[model samples]
Target: MGLLKGIDPILTADLLWVLRAMGHGDRLAIVDCNFPAAQVAKSTVTGKDPIILTVPLPQAVSAICELLPLDYFEESSVFYMAPQDGVAMPPEGNAVIDELKSAIATVSSPDVSIAPVERFQFYEEAKKCFAIVQTLERRPYGNAILVKGVIGPDGKDLKPN
Candidate 1:
């Protein structure tokens, strides 16, 4: 039997496959319900097929973070969609960002910081990711992008098991 801790029940098998298929430096976008995921995903630079999830924004992002190690090579591996109208981060946006930071800290380092990108720029960035998860979150700025990192070896026995 295979058992993995910290795996959220909302992570479906398709989502798991997407995670496993992603390599170091690959990016994953978790967007809100209003995001044009289907249109954007069709044109990513990644040659692989894109995966989209329709759960809540926070749940999808947190669940993905639980299993996906973040890429620390970049200054800020996480990015949020900024409002095109130059508005402030709403309470919901702040809550989602905080939740993502807390979740990333559990699996990786505590210094993970999320940057912001303009609305159109965010869509372009999403077009380069390996996959995009479209959540049911109706909030305007609930989108986020995560870069994947490599997992270390199982042990240092100096031989294969």
Candidate 2:
């Protein structure tokens, strides 16, 4: 069966609320299986309830990107988890990047670049984001973070298409 028109079921009500509530420059983090989600989203910390979407990383990340305009002002709006402890980006990370690129293409977004953040730094960043999506992807380094951009008065993207 199909979802309601223009409504993606992959984006749950909680996720949608978080997206809608976020203003421009707000960041959203989509984390892999290995990341610490609950620990970071503590009410004692950011005072915002944690949002977890139990889908695969690529789907969650792409769907989110499709709905939310990315921050074009930044040098890199999307960030992936960099290799840590002398390891490099795993095969899965590459696949996730390909998936994200395809999503950016599907949306006709002008900026398709994704930056890398060290493991601990990524976690710290995620802790401060508007929300975090905990995907079921078992692949190492499948995490990604996205910064939100603004929509213009003419109903066009503020960031170039």
Candidate 3:
């Protein structure tokens, strides 16, 4: 088995798919363990409609957010999500969240608003994105939707963080 340097191993397949689907202005959604990804993501490459994936949600997200070259996407559309309930963001994702925010911000098209969606709203948004990865993470309200923005053709190349 091979690996993408710096990306968590748990992200392999989903991250690969994310890198493949997203281009400038495209989007990827990372939902909680309980979130339903199969219902939202683009049809699988294998042509299987009910394919189930098992992995850590945030790690998968962070992996793609951490490594892929930013040659064909937007910066302003990149976002992180958490339940809009009054509680603080899930503790387990704090470091991952922080790292993801910093990494995406370095991009020129990063989303200006890192908005948090209410539980039900997040579900609806998932249906609209390019794909969603249902994580094994059980943290409450652990959801993030990263809108793909164009990677400037004239911008400098990116290295894994």
Candidate 4:
């Protein structure tokens, strides 16, 4: 029932296995409840059902960051779903986005780029990810994708040559 001391309870054994199985440069999509996760997941590398987490966006991101390193090889390691109308996010959505950003920042390298992708583009990209994780976050556009990075023998993020 219990995992390692610092591990978040939200991270189940199956989720941990997925994370461990992922290689550097693989992608992990963390999507909101409204996201068509089941449909998109079918097209992902894993070609399996999404790992569902009954937690808020920020909480899920924080827990995942504890074990998954963000890819430094890419120009941007994190991508969030952008508004379809190109308008600013609503106050509630912005708040949720802000919290998720903060949570990712706390665990990721300072140089990690967090960018936004168009809604449709995000969906396309999510379909290419290694796996999808559906969270109970209800805020609009609360979807993000993380590029996995490697930890070198020195126990630090592997930098590109």
Candidate 5:
């Protein structure tokens, strides 16, 4: 299989699936260590990330984004979650941001906006994302949400018809 820079190989298959079905406005959540994924996955029983799970949130997001197209020009093409305190986010959060930049280097992802919300708001949104990829990172607020965008008719990443 092909690969993207900074992406870890463990979740490559799942990342590929993210690429195929998710469309603009569709979201992907990269959860931090304590997200209660085990409880979240109770319905499907997709076992939680094992204690031995490797890969950091940034690396996981990078891998998942690879499956996604970089053009997020639609109004809701891409969205991110940060703390509502509105304090300057920490550098760790930028990990995903950097990857997004790299992914969009050759495309347009204006819809790709990172919005800060209350921690609770993030949980609510995370529940509805196209899907969430739980990472092994133990850092707090390392979570992120990304909306999908489409390639424009003119060959740019814009909202789909």
Candidate 6:
């Protein structure tokens, strides 16, 4: 077990390494069980298998957000998979995303935007991520991409000089 204090126990060594190694602007995909993680992971920056975590989507996202600084440079640093119908978010998806938004607000700015990408487009975006973390969430569309940001020299979020 990691001896690091205040770190979430859910963040295993492999996950911690991935989170720490990713540079600013690099993306990390947290997808549901139904996502094609292996196929998408092969094309990711790490070019490796997905890191499987036995937790629900909200739990996984909360843990990751605790340590991962979201990109403030981009217009929308976080992205979720939009529903196929494109009219409204499914109830399950809405619940998950609402939780995600609250989790992110704690780490980053309260105003940090979480955009939605079409299903296929999200897969394409996931491929470009540095790594993928597949959670044991059974609900559909419980998938998101988090862009890594850096801590400034002052120990705060990086911003324009």
| Alpha-carbon runs more than 4 Å astray in model 6 | 85-88
RMSD (Cα, Å) for all candidates, in order, is: 5.0, 2.7, 5.5, 1.5, 5.1, 1.6
Q: What is candidate 6's lDDT per residue for 32-150, written digit by digit as tens?
A: 99999999999999998999999988889889988888888899989999866536677988888887788788766787889989888899999999999999998878899999888
Tens digit of per-residue lDDT, candidate 5, span 1-161: 67666655666555555557676656666677778655543322123332223676666656555556544453344445566675666676666555544543323433355555567787777767666677787666666667676656775544434
TM-scores of the candidates are 0.80, 0.87, 0.61, 0.93, 0.63, 0.92
What's model 6's lDDT at 139? 80
Sorted by lDDT (best first), the order is 4, 6, 2, 1, 5, 3
Ranked by lDDT, the better of candidates 2 and 5 is 2
lDDT of each: 0.76, 0.77, 0.55, 0.90, 0.58, 0.88
What is residue 109's positional error in candidate 4, in angstroms? 2.4
State the lDDT of candidate 3 residue by residue for 39-92, as single tens digits.
555443332232234655445555566544443323335455565567666676
How would you encode candidate 2's per-residue C-alpha lDDT over 1-161 as one tens digit per residue? 34567777888887787888889988888887777777766622245556677788888877887678787877888888887778877787788777766766677474556788988888888877877778887787888888888878977557664
Cα TM-score of candidate 5: 0.63
Model 6 global lDDT (CA atoms, 0 to 1)? 0.88
The residue-level lDDT of candidate 6 at 80 comes to: 92
Query: Model 3: how far is 47 from its true place, Å?
Result: 9.1
lDDT of model 3 at position 131: 61
* Residue 8 miss distance in model 5 (angstroms): 6.0
Q: Which candidate is the best by TM-score?
A: 4
Better-scoring candidate (lDDT), 2 or 6:
6
For candidate 4, write residues 26-88 as lDDT tens digits: 999999999999999999999999999999888999999889988888899999998877587
Q: What lDDT score is found at residue 20 in candidate 5?
A: 73
Model 1 lDDT per residue over 1-161, tens place: 25467677778776798888888789888888888888887876544444556676777877787788777667788888876775777888777767666766665567776788888899999998887777888777888999886665852111212
Best by lDDT: 4
